[model samples]
Target: MDKSVSKSSQPSGGNGFPTSSSNGRKLNKKLVYLCSIVMAVLFFLGIAAFVFLFLLHKNPKATNKNIASFRVDSIFVSRFKLSSSKITASWDIRLSVQNPSTASVSYQTFYTWIQYKQERLSNVTNIAPFQVRGNNWTAENGKLVAKSVRADEKVIEDMATEMANGSVNFNIGLYAGFWIGNEEAKRVWRAVEAHCSDLKIGFSSKDNMGKLIGEPIECILTKTW
Candidate 1:
């Protein structure tokens, strides 16, 4: 009886192999937890990237440099009335210009009358200083400048006389894109570099409820005459 030993109770493998049901269950649970952790990490990374991109889009000041083109719309001379005075010569011209961009913008316009024989320009009538608005437009800030071809009366007077005598065919700029090359316009142009800039003509339309309404800055025609 003393020599009897229990062989059935002894371990089957020499190494500590996980043969118990509890050990197997624990291994499966650990494997599942590892997989879940990896999946969560990947999902979090995707969400982070999406949020970053969305914020970039929402930035107001950030602009797309590669915007293919700036456009002008609904442009018309609208009306023209010539006025004569002993004091000075001035033309009352009304023009409507529009900026077609969804983003806010600023721009300028520049032009001069042609010195025709009978319509010989002794000087630029109704001369006005350059102005800009709507999108922070300014003439002083542009690296490239907008210039008038024949704004001075004396220089243009000689050219006008030459035209009247049939010595020169005097053609002056009547309409142009910029009218003049200036700052806000070069970065964002509705037309040429030399266009009139400093004029305030805009409109805001609202609904009947006194709520916010559509506000489109249209070029207002002042009494040019």
Candidate 2:
């Protein structure tokens, strides 16, 4: 009788290596497909973000409207103190602020300084912040007590002459920071400056002390961002 050997039925590749199961091949194909989809989505998202940021940078004014709608409505000098070395004044001022944009605006820590002939006389700081609604006007009131302003001989002389003339010309400087939009929307912060020129303060001399003659005079106001 002749002896015959039988071979197994397992599948093999060209290299004669055992092939993977059909289920395992299917699972590998699914994983590769899923990875490709995820990569495509991420690439599209990155491109969209880049375009948005580019547009935002190009049109900054659209994001933050200029805060030019600020003005000095009125001012009232309640007390005045003049001395040989320094001068001090206290006053209440009212401001009219308008938000022209559709978004709200807010500011913190207001400061004001009184100047005469380009000389800094006094300054007040640390006032409270204010907020204005969209496309609306609001009145903000604050009191300022200026610190003692040291003066030289020429300044004192000019002050005396102006007091004798019954009107003193002064300048007022204002500074603050403003933020656009509310908490829900993106916010932008900017610095603002205001200058009121030729503010004429009228006073009368009584018993060697200066007394306010009438309401504070309105002055030319200019603003910069």
Candidate 3:
């Protein structure tokens, strides 16, 4: 009697290897794992950024306290004359700066100016670079000179009226960049703007000399990036 023969049930791939469908499934799995790894890395980075911003938002008062403070101790005007066309003045400004940071602070790009009402009457003079120790105060004596500076009509009128009444109010403005670090290292840099307004200086008769009155004025401070 003759026996019946049956065909082989193995895959068609060479050397009895896995079929094309099985190879496709393995490649798909690899792609999935790669995508998952990339997404996980991105997610952690995003979380880190959010945490940093949240901490900054929650500690505004601490940030302000750690920056610094500025105060105008006194001002002496030796010569101040103004007209509609021109202005001239010599000012000796005594000021103090307090650094609350733990690191030493150095200041540069120091600028000082004088303003009458809202009108500026002098050029912005550059002060010498200086440094203040950590958690300490430093006194800076600044001399501002304005010679033949063009004056606005409103500024001259207001200044003359105030001088005639025995006292004139002017605003002293200062700006500088502060670096927080020791002499051997630098960590961060910041810009600060300080305005000491309502500076009442008393003058007698038509004399150009004047002295600051009342208490020392603490300047309003603003920080820039």
Candidate 4:
């Protein structure tokens, strides 16, 4: 009798393709992960861009507009009642101003050797730049303060100590107003006005150097308690 033959079944290997489908599936999974990572990055970038654009559109200050303004909120002249202190006028003043535009505004503020009742006082120099706009204090409309006299015993101080303590005994008015422009003549006027001996006089801005007022503007100065 002839011997019977048997064969075992097994995967083919000579073509180098029996495990290719599994390898291809692994590759697809890696690609999916890579795509997911790329999508995440793009999503974050898109969100950041959207936020930036939203702020730019919703806020005018963030937009393009560069015209600032300022004001003399309050003024305090110490010793008005007692008139003590032979500098018969050692004083501290308070002024509030604003920047209503987009860019920063700058100007020099010189102490006007006040020639009031025939007395030569000390001169003060203030070459400081005021920048409280869209970058800071935007909600309050770019408002800032100068607490020290341009030419006083103190360069600048958070004044009104007497007023805060109900100890001030003087009465006087310190009025002020000005405008900054994008012109040479206006720049000249900034210097001229800063050196003028009349900031304590009146707020008649209509009679200034020119009929043009640009960057900064203030309301009529008034005396207040």
lDDT of 4 at 40: 100
Q: Candidate 4 — worst ten consecutive residues by lDDT sum?
A: 208-217
Best of the two (1, 4) by lDDT: 4
Q: Which residue pairs of candidate 4 clash?
A: 67-101, 68-100, 70-98, 80-170, 81-169, 81-170, 124-151
Cα shift from native, residue 175, model 3 (Å)? 0.8
Candidate 2's TM-score: 0.61
Best by lDDT: 3
Model 1 has an lDDT value of: 0.35
Select the stronger candidate by lDDT from 3 and 4: 3
Better of 3 and 4 by TM-score: 3
| Full-model lDDT, candidate 2 | 0.68
Task: Give Cα-based local distance difference scores for all models.
Answer: 0.35, 0.68, 0.83, 0.35
lDDT for 87 in candidate 1 is: 13
Better of 1 and 2 by lDDT: 2
Model 3 stretches with alpha carbons more than 4 Å out: 1-65, 183-186
lDDT by residue for model 3 (52-165), tens: 888766533236544778888999998788777788889999989988776778887789898887777778888899999887999999888888888777778878888899
* Per-candidate RMSD, Å: 16.5, 12.0, 8.3, 16.4
Residue 140 local lDDT, model 2: 75
The backbone clash count of each candidate, in order, is 27, 0, 0, 7
